[model samples]
Every structure is written in structure tokens, then in C-alpha cells.
Target: MSTAQALSPSSRAESLKKLEETELDVLVIGGGVVGAGSALDAATRGLKVGLVEARDFASGTSSRSSKLFHGGLRYLEQFNFALVFEALRERSLVLNSLCPHLAKPVPFIYPLEKLIDRPYVGLGIGVYDVMGAGRGVPSHHKHVGKKKTLESFPSGKRSAIRGSVKFYEGQVDDARHTMMLARTAAEYGALCVNSTRVIGFLREEGRVVGVKAVDLETGRAFEIRARQVINAAGVWTDEIQEMVGGRGQFQVRASKGVHLVVPRNRINSSTGIITRTEKSLLFVIPWGSHWIIGTTDTDWNLDLAHPAA
Candidate 1:
């Protein structure tokens, strides 16, 4: 077991000094979920690892997610069974074995509109439940009539609904979860430093060596030498790749998603609601005293760092 390490000012200074001085087995860029997870994985495996973040941890798309650990119910319609299965397994691991304290099972109701909607939606959710069985959450889904559906979601329109199928999904505060991941990686002997930006890649004879970085707080430039450099910059991934003359095998595009939060009383729902839109799925998720609704997807071609909502 690894001892807990505090992400304090002293720790940050020490980490920075060590990063400037030592050579690492793996150096991770970005402080999002993927980068933090990579650092944790490397450190736990007894590899010398270092993680750097441009801004605060989870300050980008990682924190701006829908925050549900669902098994992609819509993926079933696309016949993407492998992706769905993998997501369900990861969701189970997160809720049960990984971050049980940071995540929990939340019930959601998929409301039906037409009489014919029951069997179709029910079949889908039934398959979803079966696929996710014994993975952590409740293995079965419940079907409720209109009366019970309205009872559960009193704010729902009366004329549009027929019945509902209820299923379970995991919920989390994405920011805290990601921050904890970095801290845990640090505890496992990975040097984690946020507010540090990688300006360019350090290359030797056309092979990447490490990175040239700047500490945003002090504006001090430094170099971190490592055998391998992993870029997990999320939306800013392309920028990192470009620093190396854009030789990366893949390119990344950015999408902007917007969500609205309203007081819980405005919805009058005890459970979350999922509905179908013409283009995608709509969710009215229950969060504390408020409901998180919406999520408009659009192409983002402007700023990668500070995206306007």
C-alpha cells in the first residue's frame, strides 16, 4: 500500500526541484482524468513517473462533463456492444472497487411517450441491465406505469408519457475525482505538479526525449528528462502534438457541450430523467438541490483553453 501524499506548497516545490533534477521513466502531460490515471498506473507499477498540468487539475473538459458513469444506453442502438460492455465494466470498477466514496449509484427513469414506446424502450433497458449485471449496481431494471412515473417525476408533462423504465447509473463530481487521482498518483511516488505548462518537446536525433516546461506561478522555465512522454491534454492534445512538428499519428478535434443547472424544486423529481431528442439524448439529472439539464453539442473551432459557454 502507498502512503498518502499531500499536494501542499512544500510538496509542489520539492516535486518541481526533483523534476528539474532527475530522469523519469514516464512523463505525462495534462492534469485531466486520463493523464492522472496514467500517472497513477505508472507509479503503482514502480515506474518513475511525473505528471504536469497547464492549469488546475480538471479545469477543462474533464470537469465539464455530464458526470454520469452510465454504460452508454444509446450505444446499444448503434450495435456497439463491445464499447457498451467495456464502459459497463469500467463503471462497475469505479463504483465498487475504485472510488466508492466519490461515486454512487443513482437511479434514472427513461420516460416513454407513445404506447408503442414501452416494449421498444423496455427491451433496450433490459438488455442494458443484463449486460451490466453483477458489475456493481443493481442488476435489474424496473418498469413503472404512468402513475408511478409521475409520482417519481411530478414535474413531467402529463399528456406525453405512457410509462417508464428505471435503471441505475453511477454519479460523481468529476473535478474532485480527477484531483484525487493526481494526489493518489503522487502518493504512489509520481511527481505531480499542476500550474505547469509544457511549451515544447525535447528531442534528440529526431527521437523525443522529454519536455520543456514553464512554471506558471513563477514563470520559470525548466526541462524534465524522461524516457517516454505521454500526452493526455484532452482538448489541447493537438497543441502538444504540434510542438513536435505534428508528427503524431492522430489528430484531435474539439466539441463544446453546454449544460444548465436549475433548482431541484423546479423539476419536482425524486429521480433523474432521460429523454430522447431529435439529435441526441436529453438528461435532467438530480444533483443535490439542483437538476443538471441540457448538453448542446457543437463544433468548437475557437479557443481551446477558455471556451465560451
Candidate 2:
């Protein structure tokens, strides 16, 4: 069995932090990827760890992601070698070892509208696909002519689309995967409790120490002490730092991305599609009985909780 699957329910319960505990090896704030990762890493190393979140796990940017485990194709256009390589490696790990059940191969088709568009787009995508060859997902392939293209993607307007190129990428249940990370960390003995808000920081001799928090459910205050603390609150990161009485090093901007889900029959296509927009790449991802589209990225300042269309 996989390491993640081997983790039992009883082993996944948090027990490292007792109520009113005064000390711990590590305290992780924010229940997102990095925070949960730190807690799991620390706990696996035999350290007493605690992870507290003010809301449900992955209830922020993590859950609002595009849900793809891919090396961004747009990043390739900028010649970002390091970023592509790193992301490709991470994607491979996720598909092969990390969460095979949650992540799977997804084929996406790039519609070639013009005759000249094929060579240019195909060549670039070809290089990208070759780079990912032998990496967990399948290599990219192309199709031409109305018959072949229609055979591959019957839903497309054959008159508008000269042909299409088929490529494989990875998709994941982002929320489920992130929650699995938290559960895995708890299995390793990390004390994790959601709905516990961190109000302030605890200090001694002007040195950093623990956190003063309140249970949102019960409205009770408590102090969770630890030798070191990690902040992994994605968008609210700056807010957490401010409460600690320290100015943040860099500012974080909130970008809202919204996805619209429609039934698969609305846009009947054999494979998913990725098209270039003025500002961002638009993906028509297939999700079983439904197809997810949109993902409009707008500067959000009003309420980080919800993004307006």
C-alpha cells in the first residue's frame, strides 16, 4: 500500500497538543499546503507539532486553484526553465507517488484555428511535450484534416478549427488533496484543530515564542506554545504578520479567479481545451458529467472571501 493509504484513522487523530499546553517543537499557522507540509515534515521527524486554522482546511486560495498539477505552458513562453523543470518534477511526484488516487491524466486539445497557427503553436507545444516525456503523463500528439480533427473532438466547429493537437496534463481534486495532507500530518502526530483563530503572538524577553488564539466554536482563549512558528496563510499572510507585531517583508496581492461549471452536453468535446486569452489562458476542463470553464482573474480588494464576476 502507498504510504498515504497505509495511514490509519486512529493514527490520523491529533494528540500532540493538549488544551493549555505550554510547549511544542513546531507550530504551523494556516492549514494550506505549506503549513500542512511543515507540520507533516516536523511530525515525521519525531517533533511535537501543532497546526491551527481559523476555518476549514484549504478554505482559501488552495481550494480556489485551477486544480491542475501541470508545468504552466505559458511559463514556457517566457523561457522560464527553472520554473518549468521544478513544476514538472513536482507534477511527476504527485502523479507517481504522492496522491495517485486524487491526481490523474487529463488530455487537453489546443484548437488550431488558422493554417499558420498549427506550425507555430504545434512546434512550441511539441517542445513542451517532449520535455515531459517519460515524466508520469503521456506525450503530446497532433491531428490534422477535418475528418481526423472531428474524430478526435466531435464538438468543435470543424469549419473554424483547421485541426487540433492532443496533449496530456494532470488534474487533481485540490480541496480533497489538501485535506489529505492535513490528515496525513495528523496521522504523524501533529496537533491540528480547525476553527481555532490565532489572535496574537506570545513573546518572552523580546524573542518570538508561541501564539495566543481563541476557539471560534466555543469562543474560548488559549495559548499554544512552540519553539518555532510557520505562517502559511496564503492571502491573509500579511494580516497574520501584523498581529505578531512585525511588519511583513513583502506585500501580498489578492487575485480573484472564478470558475463556471456547466454540464458536459453544453460543450460536447472528447478532450479538454486550452485557449489563449488577452490576459490569461482559458481552460475548458472536463470533470466527469460537467465541464468547468471561465477562471477570470481580477484584482480583488473588497472581500477576499468572495470574488464577483
Candidate 3:
């Protein structure tokens, strides 16, 4: 949203020229948060850098995440303590230090359904508190009775609200956050260019030295030389690896997810809600004056650019 930091026509032209003329220390593929963060890190370290993405920033899964930057509290039930700790720590860095402007605390109420589920759920949340202790976020959970639960979410079906547990998590405008990362890297002297597709890798004696890219808008191909190339192309990662002509260490799989946005008045909730589906958990997150309810996660086999309803 910051125009001076945005990718402009003049800036893109200058970056393309720089890519063709300068020998970079790092050439980052993909313009998602991972790619942008890599560019920022490399540029801040005083390395010459270039970033290319086939589409807009966060056009992929980076924008479609659960949108919560929390320490996966649900994972506590599975005994994944380390993962939860690590995620919460990162969440702290983002909310408290990294980019506080793009993210903030959002509260969620996990309503209890069956009478027998309280003890187990409470214990899991207890472990969540332990893992998240000392992090900037509040580690304690608020026990809410059915009366209080109804006060928070009056539109909830009566049968579903036995009681509730309130907790806090960080939420971000993912698309905006991603663009800011790319722009910040650009401000730090990384030649960040989106809508540029990597068609092939530039090689010398069986080692990758750069990339051959084409401007998606102009259809003109250009070669860029670099000491190292990083593939952060997300779902298309395997394709880049194949172009590198080597057996990949791990494969990337694409998962399709979709979110439904509804007016805030429809839910009539003071706090967001979290519920479990048969296979996964669904979040009804508070989004300003709107509520986001979503998301179906299944292996994607159709078009990568668009998914069917």
C-alpha cells in the first residue's frame, strides 16, 4: 500500500537493467514472503541481490494461509511441543519486533461442545500456555461459561455452546505484509521484480550460475548472472528443481484452500471462533468489519492459478 515503496514501472525498468548488467551475489526466484525475506536478508548483509516472481507477490499460498500467526495451540493435543514453541517464538518476533504495523492481536473463543471434552481440551490449552510462556502474547486462557460465551457470540447455535476458552493470537493482512517485505528488500537495494518468470537456469560446467527470465508483460527474455540461485517458488518449486536437472531432496505439494468473507453483522460475535472439521480445523476470524470463514484443504490437481468452487 506504500506507493513510494511499491513496484513501479520506472523501478521495474531499472531493476531489469541491473539484472542484465550486474553480477549479483544472490538471485532469488519467487516473490512470496520466503523469497522476499531471503532478498531482504541478503541485501542487508551487503550482498548484491535480485528477485524474480512469475506473478504478483503473495499470489500463491503465502496469501492463503490460516492468517493467524499463532503458536499452533491445537498441535499441543498432538504433543508437538517443539513446533508450537518455535512458531510462537517467530510469532513474537513478528508482532513485537519484525513488522508490528502489519500484524496485531486477535482473540478467539473455542467453544466446548460435548460435556466430556472439557478436561482434555483444558489440559491441551494448559500445555499451550506453557509453550507460549514469556512470549509477548498472553499465555493464559480465559475460562468462559455458557452465559459469557453467548455474550460473545450470540449467533452461535444453542446446542454447540456448552462453554468456551478464550485465547489470543496474532493476525495479519497477509497480502499487504508480503508486499511490504518485497518493497523493504527493494529499499535495501535488492532488485526485486515481480511478473518476471524464470524460464531456465544459466549454467556453467554443470553448476547453476544465474537464471534466464522473461518479463511476463513484455515477453522479452533476459539472462542474469549470480553467484548463487535460490528456489523459493512455493508450489512450483519442483519445476525449478527439474530445470536444475538434479534429483530433488524433497518434493513440494500444492494444497488448495479457500476463504469465505461475510459481513461482521452476520456472525454477531465480539470474538472470532475456532471449530474442528472432520479432517481439519476451520477458523472464523475477525477481519475489521468482516468475518472470514473458510477453508477447504485438499490436494490440488487442477489449474494452479484458479481453483473450482
Which candidate should be chosen as best, given TM-score against the real structure?
A: 1
> Model 2: runs farther than 4 Å from truth?
1-19, 143-145
RMSD for all candidates, in order, please.
Answer: 1.2, 2.7, 2.1
Clashing pairs in 2: none
> How many backbone clashes does every candidate have?
0, 0, 0
Candidate 2 lDDT by residue in tens digits, 1-309: 223423333332333237255488889999887787788889889998888888878887788777889888888888996787788888889999888889998988888888788888888788777777647786556655656777867878867888777788899988888888888887776777778889999999987699898878678788988889888888888899898776678688888888998999998778889888998789999987988896897788887766666
lDDT of 3: 0.86
Rank ordering of all candidates by lDDT, starting from the highest? 1, 3, 2
Cα lDDT tens digits, model 3, 235-277, are 8888899989865887978777888999998888898898888
How well is each residue in 1-309 modelled by candidate 1, as lDDT tens digits? Answer: 654578998999999999999999999999999999999999999999999999988998889888998889879889899999999999999999998999999989999998799999999999888889847786579989999999988888999888899989999999889999999999999999999999998989988999999999999999999999999988888888889885477678788888999988887888899999999889888888888997888989998887778
Q: Model 1: residues >4 Å from true position, as ranges?
A: 1-3
Which candidate model has the greater TM-score, 1 or 2? 1
Which residues of candidate 3, in runs, are more than 4 Å off?
1-4
Return the TM-score for each candidate structure: 0.97, 0.91, 0.94
Clash pairs for candidate 3: none
Ranking by TM-score: 1, 3, 2
For lDDT, the strongest prediction is: 1
